[model samples]
Target chain A: MLLIEMFVFLGTIAFAISGSLLAIQKRLDIFGVLLLGLTTALAGGVIRDLMIGNIPPTNLAEPQYFLVSLLASLSTIIFFERIKKFNHSIAFFDAIGLGVFTAVGANAVLSFEYSQPFLIITMGLVTGIGGGVLRDVFVQEIPQVFRKEVYGMASIAGSVALIISYDFVSPIISLYICLTVTFTIRMLALKWKW
Target chain B: MLLIEMFVFLGTIAFAISGSLLAIQKRLDIFGVLLLGLTTALAGGVIRDLMIGNIPPTNLAEPQYFLVSLLASLSTIIFFERIKKFNHSIAFFDAIGLGVFTAVGANAVLSFEYSQPFLIITMGLVTGIGGGVLRDVFVQEIPQVFRKEVYGMASIAGSVALIISYDFVSPIISLYICLTVTFTIRMLALKWKW
Candidate 1:
């Protein structure tokens, strides 16, 4: 659980950076940048929680994640030019966020005692892609995920793996399997131009 | 209660028709039209249900709304040419939906016994706009509600009206007040080019 928590924060940072950079690119104000960053980092989990009837969504109720994403967004703004000198791409952080969120979301459904395969997979997929979809929507673009089949396919594969191995493997091990599968697929798609 | 039920159906039809027409204008295929229609008609209520922790959301669990939306979409497709003559505009149906959904959604929050004003207002707003937002996103457009300030403000005002009047008035009357406020504001905004 601690390991999962650690990865969640890392994923949060990745998503915040990805979202804030895009906001800057779009010439949004500081408030817009912060709003986009938070949405990218936390909207998925908030939506997942709502579906499971978890009110006062964790991202809102728990201050730590909020603070972490806020700091990440602020850093991105402060270091915008510095980061651009290195040519930091959005895809890299997005991939990491996607993979980790996929596994974490699947695990959450299990914790809530929802074992129906469709629900578990949908939860995982939604958790992984929901934030990005929302970010794209807010930015008024067709979601790249929908356009890029491989992106969604990667998350789906990971979610499916998590569900299959959940009964046999330890929770931590299952999470790793899910993460590895999705990250590998996404990276391959990016590299091979799939 | 039956009156609420009747209006819900009417709103569902209105949203479905509006969404399907947009899809047609976008030159989407039949499936796209149907998908957008369903999304517009039901996604708001589904989101609202999920927020309340209502599993297997009423829209999904109860077959009636789904059927109505489906029929509405089918009719729009069949009567496409005839509808063009009537010069029907999306704004009209959208306004009706905003009013009814805002009222219905606010009432749902009360039924859940959660009295938090922010949450209740949000539930109402989301229920009124969620589906339209989703529809616009799928078409790769900026959400009309976000761009047109009056659209969202109308929903917000209605939600506020519902919240203020809920405690003092009967449930049905409160619903009417919410509906009237939202509908009138939306219509006036359209008429006056606000």
Candidate 2:
């Protein structure tokens, strides 16, 4: 459980940095930079929580999540030139973030006992991609997930894998399966430009 | 109250038809057309309900809303050529939708006792524009509300009106004031091309 939480936090920071980097690239103001970063880091979980009737979503209610993302975004904005040199590492961490979000989302729905197979998978996919979609839409660009190589597909696959393994394995094991599957696929997509 | 519900229904139809029209213009499939129409008609309320902990939003739980949007979308798709002739009528109804949604959104926040001044106004603005933003994002367009003249501003003004009048007037009357303010501003913006 602790291990999973650790990765999720790392994912949050990675997403925040990525969001801020994109905002800077777009030449948004300081406020815009911060807003975009927070949105990308938190929007997915917030949307998922809302759909499941989790009011005052954890992302918003927990100051720790907000603080972590804020620091991540600020650092990225301040040191963008240096961070730009670590493009490969950023992408690698982003892939991990994608994997963790997908698995965690699926688990959330399952834990809620919604009893709908589709809801589990749908929530999983949305939780993985929602932030990026909002980020792109804010910038008035087509969502890269819709147009980019294998992104949504990778998330979908990971969610599907989780659903399939969930009945057979421990919940934690299922999460690992999902995270591994998603990260592997996303990384492969990036490696060969799939 | 019945009168307000009637106008809200009218607004729902208008938003649905407008969403479908844009979908058809973009040459999307029948499924895309239907999805966009439903999205424009209901997403705002869903988002609002989620924020206030209204589980299984009325927009989704109540069949009437879905039926209205579905019928509106279907009719728009079938008689698009004829509908094109009523451009003026559609805009008029859409303006009504914008007004009612803004007022209702503010009233909802107030009724729920959210207690934050900004929450009331923010919910109102988001409800008025959320559907349109989702619709535009689905089609990869910059949200019309963000770029268009005075669309979001009108909603903001109406919400402010509601908050100001709530202390002195009946809730229904506050809604009326909000509706009138939003509608008048939207209409003026359209007329003067602001």
Please, what is the whole-model Cα lDDT of each candidate in the order they appear? 0.85, 0.86
Model 1 residue A63 distance off true place after TM-score fit, in angstroms: 11
lDDT of 1 by residue, A1-194 (tens): 58778888988999998888888887776766876788899899988987776785677546677789989999999999886565435577778889999998888898898889898888888889899988887887778788998998999899889878888999889998998899889989998989
| Candidate 1 ranges with C-alpha deviation above 4 Å | A1-38, A50-129, A137-194, B85-89
Compared with the true structure, what per-residue lDDT tens digits does model 2 show for residues A1-194?
59999999998998898888888887776656776788898899989998887765677545677779889999998899999899999999889989999999988998888858789888888889899888888877778898976898898899899989988999999999999999999999999998
DockQ for candidate 2, C-alpha atoms: 0.16
The per-candidate count of clashes, in order, stands at 1, 0
TM-score of each: 0.64, 0.61
Tell me how far the alpha carbon of residue B117 in candidate 1 is from the true structure, in angstroms, after superposition: 1.9
